[model samples]
Target: MPNFNNLQYASEPGSPTSPSEDWAQATADLIVVLDGATARTETGCSHGISWYAEHLGKSLLLAAADTTLSLVGVAKSAISRVACLHPECDLTHPGTPSAGIAMLRPDGRYFVLGDVAIVAESTDGIAVIVDERVSQTGVAERAEVDHYLIGTPEKAAALLPMKRAELAARNIPGGYWIAAADPAAADHALVGHLGLDDGAPVAVLTDGAARAEVFGLLDWAGLLDLAVAAGPLELIQRVRAAENSDPLGAKWPRNKASDDATMVTASVAS
Candidate 1:
């Protein structure tokens, strides 16, 4: 049977005072990571982003344990399960709690939605999978926000229009899909199987942990090497250090100086 060994996992919140909107969990046959979308405007749900991520992550893990279900089916079941948890909320609201998802099954099947990523090494080569549709949506608004330092009033003001645009573009035919109230979003996930070599490296990351690649600090192979040598937490620390070096958006411009980061690393075995 396929299994994972030498697993290393870590998570850190963007702000020390706030609960992390990212969540990760690993079972004998599955690895799941979720990055909750921060609600810049009002979300119709009272349970909030963190709650949505945790419930979705847990539900996905449970559903994936069945092994017989396809990854898309797992995602559909999980989203539907979470939606049932808050029947009183306005699930139809555009800003309803949602998250990016990345999941790996023991047989080398991988599923990705939104910005979360899955990087795996196999006999064929290295494969990195992530959905970049959201990044393509808010170009002008995102550029404006990146001009100012994170946490500044200017940046906050700029984020409002960007977030509004994002909500407007979300889950439409031309827009991106995420784990939310609608189970149909699961059908939009990127899915495939990798012939992962025995003892090959694998990493699943939320976008925050993946910012290193976005910033050109490290390539996917290098990041996996770091995780193997130092540990997964070191990857988070490296990202934090990089973010600290560019606090004012002078070097690397972005909407936030820091974001909730989560990573899971392991070696494939059978």
Candidate 2:
């Protein structure tokens, strides 16, 4: 059997007033992860990330509890419910809701979506299971801008027409799971495994922590490795130190430079 443990945290790096990002977990020899979409409207009264995140997290738990539907089914149902409740959410087209999810199941099956990563830890090293939508690949890219920004039924229809087609164009890397981007709601990719008989630690993290450069720093993998070797408190301090080292004049390219970062690390007992 696999033993599981998780840690959750939230931070408001950019705006002092709006703390929209949400995180949640459910353990049953498996784990589910989600990142709600940041709201597009500036004055929509809490219409952005937090609303979707809270709904997605609760919906995921409901799906896990329901026996009739598969994980994917539960997620789709949840998206529908969310859409109904928040009529303002433009889910019809290629709009990507808050992204990424990984379900670790007892049957050894794992399903993942988008950029949220699933990495297997072993004596050799750590390897990522989810690949970011953007990379070195030079393939043509399409954006469903309307889908993401739509507010009306006619606008959503017009904007979303190319959503399925756009999603079809992207190429997924090997060993990485992908969920087709949905303009109005969340996207989910399913994966399964027989259980980590290998006896290594497992990690699922949001892109903020996993991104190679955050606030102008590189070698995030190196930092994660050190954190794994050291204790959690040491890891936190190390991150703090790195963030502090940035000179004021130096510009950080990240949109959410001081983003809300979260990670869940688990290992099978000896």
Please name the candidate that would achieve the greatest lDDT relative to the true structure: 1
Instruction: Return the number of clashes found in candidate 1.
Output: 0
Off by over 4 Å in 2: 1-16, 40-46, 67-69, 88-90, 93-97, 106-108, 122-125, 134-195, 212-237, 247-252
- Per-residue lDDT tens digits for candidate 2, residues 143-218, read 3222232234544453333334334333333322232223222232544453455445565656655543333344
Model 2's alpha-carbon lDDT is 0.49
The TM-scores of all predictions, comma-separated, are 0.98, 0.63
Q: Which candidate number has the best TM-score?
A: 1
Tens-digit per-residue lDDT, 70-115, candidate 1: 9999999999999999999999998999999999976799899899
Clashes of each: 0, 18
Model-by-model lDDT, in order?
0.90, 0.49
